[model samples]
Target: MPLSTLNKEQLSAATAPIGNNLIIASAGTGKTSTIVGRIAHLLQTGIEPSKILLLTFTNKAAGEMLERVGRYFPAVVVNKIESGTFHAVSYRWLKQINKNVTLKQPTELKTLFRSIYEKRQFKRLNHDVEAFSSTYLYEQYNLYQNASLDGFDIWFIDKYPDHKPLIDIYMNIIDEYEDTKDRFGFVSFNDLLIKMRQSLLENRREMQEVLVDEYQDTNTLQSALIDSIQSNSLFCVGDYDQSIYAFNGANIQNIATFGKRYNDATVFTLSKNYRSTASILSLANRVIERNERIYPKKLEVTRVSKNYPPKLLIYKELFDQYQAIARNIKNSYTPSNDIAVIFRNNASADGVEASLRELGINCKRKGGNSFFEAKEVKFLLDVLSLIVNPKDMMAFIHIFEYGKGIGTAVAKEMFECFIHFGEGHLFTGMLSPRVFNLPKLNPTKNMQLGLFDDDTQIGSISRFAHLKLSEQIKSNPILKHPKLTDDGLIFFKNFYDFLKSIKNVKQPQTMIIKLINTPLYEGIVEMLSNQRAKLKSGEIDPDKK
Candidate 1:
């Protein structure tokens, strides 16, 4: 904690707060600690915690900042201090201050196309109708629509004014969203900053000092919010070179433009790598050097790890790349250790997963949607619906057997059985019913079957199921009852708590699955495998076996 122990650059960056401050931290450069130290120093110098508005890009980051501050200086901080992701903090602002704030309806691109078709505005294009019916279409529509507005928010829209008709429609929807949210007490993630900025714009006296973390990741709305709340001081720290979220509206140029925008601004750079080995820092520096708009900062490492020159294998083909990576892992990787494979797209990881599985390498994709999108998750959601209302049995089964292509006749018969009997019976009699409608077949009588007992491991269903159940228990206020000790509930609560405790700061799923590894979770894995095998090996005996 001594000034002498600190690197010269860190010391210099921390002390120099003349105007606007920007700290460019290279990978493994102790970025969080430096940020925390800066905040601590300000607090030590008699800057009241309430006056400081610290913003992060994620809830996890906010949580971490709070935790760090609590550890460093607890009593000085207020209980409900303003700090969170830009979206979260903004949302809170809207809720607390904006009485008339409203959220827009989240419509997919397909929905927009359908609206266009219904309104007779769009004839089917020669291109693939399916492609037209995508989330991209909606994004494009939003871009087109929001591009024509007069204000800075609509600068993009105004630049492309030819899309005025679409812009008018989209703007109306955005306005309606605000109105509807105000009418029915609903606020969106983005509306937080919008409403707060509006509040300050309408009533400027309420503005206060602001401090934003990861300034490189600030979007237009967030920067605008900071601009609106520009009073005491604007302190932001980030490295534009580490800006990886350009796809998600993050504007790295904002960091570059901070001085020009804010006439009274100071820029500082932190260039000491404290987290990684010297070799790793060298590689990271080399990789990011290619990126333009990079601040002039050199990351020099003091600690040198024994491991040097982190492997960078490049293969000829995509499959070869995957196989080579997997093979390398097979040779050197250990189980239960963190090994990240970063990708620009989800599609790129699919082949890696496939190739890794082929090599019998037990690897999991770290960050992308895992547990939520699994087949088992769909199955559990279906089951939950069926349990809540037995009439939704067909719907449940359709979701459960989604990829298998269940026929209408088979679906109807299943529905009929569910109406007559119950989910427990239908589950027990899965093999007995002629779901495929061949000759009368009753496979359930032959296979040992019984009601889904409370003791059976439910987590063993699927990653999706496990994730859904975990999320449900975590989010649902009603289900947190102390008396609920049923076997399924016990399994769910235990896994949920475990997953919650091992919360991911960056790669969320990495921590989630790491938390989910237990006997109960293993059972869920087995159940999913058995279900797949049942269909593949003619063991279920329902359709044709």
Candidate 2:
């Protein structure tokens, strides 16, 4: 932790003259340590900790830096040194300026975009709107906003002519998205940086020194925010060769052109590799040197090489590849934690996972569907949200079509009707005679109630049959008889009852637990179990056979 303990390169970079310095921190060359040491030096040099800002790409990284800084420095200095992700710091500043400011979660924004996409008519495309309106679209929007593009349509058309058809639709979506956010007084993650930049410009509160980690990963907006707040004493650490997030709007040029941007900038390179062996470092350097534009730096491995030659295997087919990987994993006696099988995408993970499972090995997939984004999880969360806030029309619409037969069109119409009548809740609206005109029950279908084999369907029907639907049926015939299938009616009634049961329960965890114990959870579990069974049996090949 001492200044003398650092290698010559690290020590030099960490204690360099602080005006507009750029530290080229190659991967695993003590980047975090350098940042920590730099901050320590700043505090030691009679600089006010309050005036120094350390910005990281993730909260985890910031936490690690803070933890290390606290260990090496006094609490007085560590506490005063503001450190956090760019978004977190921005949000804090924005909140300080306006206490009432609120941010919309990514999921909520996506839902809003999806709802808008569904409501509007546009030229049909091969892609599903739900699939098309994802994080990628949001990233594109952020890029355009950051670059200050006047017209995204022209920019996108010029850049990607094949996607020109989607340009107009995306523009419309963006318009609706902006209007909705304005109405709700909501700001997005990207908006945090933009708003923070505006606030800093108006307030003109400059930091004594600003330190940025992973500077290569920064987009234009983040760079702008940094420029707005920094007092020209900037220390940025990044490796241009390691800038692999271009798809996410990261500009490698930020690192490549840093010296040019700040003419007086002192550039330092930390090329001592402490993580990988000499052989691995050689391969990495060879591969990265192929890049047309890069800051040249030779990495020298400090660690002793194992002298084991890397193996490359060729397979005739996808299954053969999976089998070979599985065999090697088994033969090597590698613990699952120490072993990593990476692929091009999530689709490739399925086959590897299947192969591992077939070999009686359990492997956890990292970075697949987020817990909140999973279909079953989302459905339950929606149901719980609807129970707590019945006016959440999106939640109501989502849950309305949980069971088969109640398609999107039907659900949309029902929601429109509820809104037209100015109803209090969906259940209350369904029971209204003015809203739904129910018909007589079909005797044949009623008699065939228990004939269904599916437990899920039978359970739903049983719940619906027990509900007092006479009042609803009298008002709307569509709500009566077999038109609303036993399965559909049952799910609706049970869900309504579940909502009512948790109506007074304020604890979200309690509600979630209760919801998870319901038949819906069981159904999801059973479905997944069946899918796994099929996968192992080779009915659904992991290799996409």
TM-score of 2: 0.74
Q: What's the alpha carbon RMSD for model 2?
A: 9.3
Backbone-clash count (model 1): 17
Off by over 4 Å in 1: 1-5, 75-80, 98-120, 124-137, 141-186, 205-208, 283-295, 333-338, 343-350, 357-360, 367-545
Where does the lowest 10-residue lDDT sum fall in candidate 2? 442-451
Tell me the tens digit of each residue's lDDT in model 1 across 251-307: 766887887887767777777667888778878778877877445777777785686
Lowest summed lDDT window (length 10), candidate 1:
443-452
RMSD of each: 15.9, 9.3
lDDT (CA) per prediction? 0.54, 0.71
What number of backbone clashes does candidate 2 have, counting pairs of residues 3 or more apart or in separate chains? 10
- lDDT by residue (tens digit), candidate 2, 204-295: 87788999999989987788888888485898999888787887778777777887888788989998989988777888888888877556
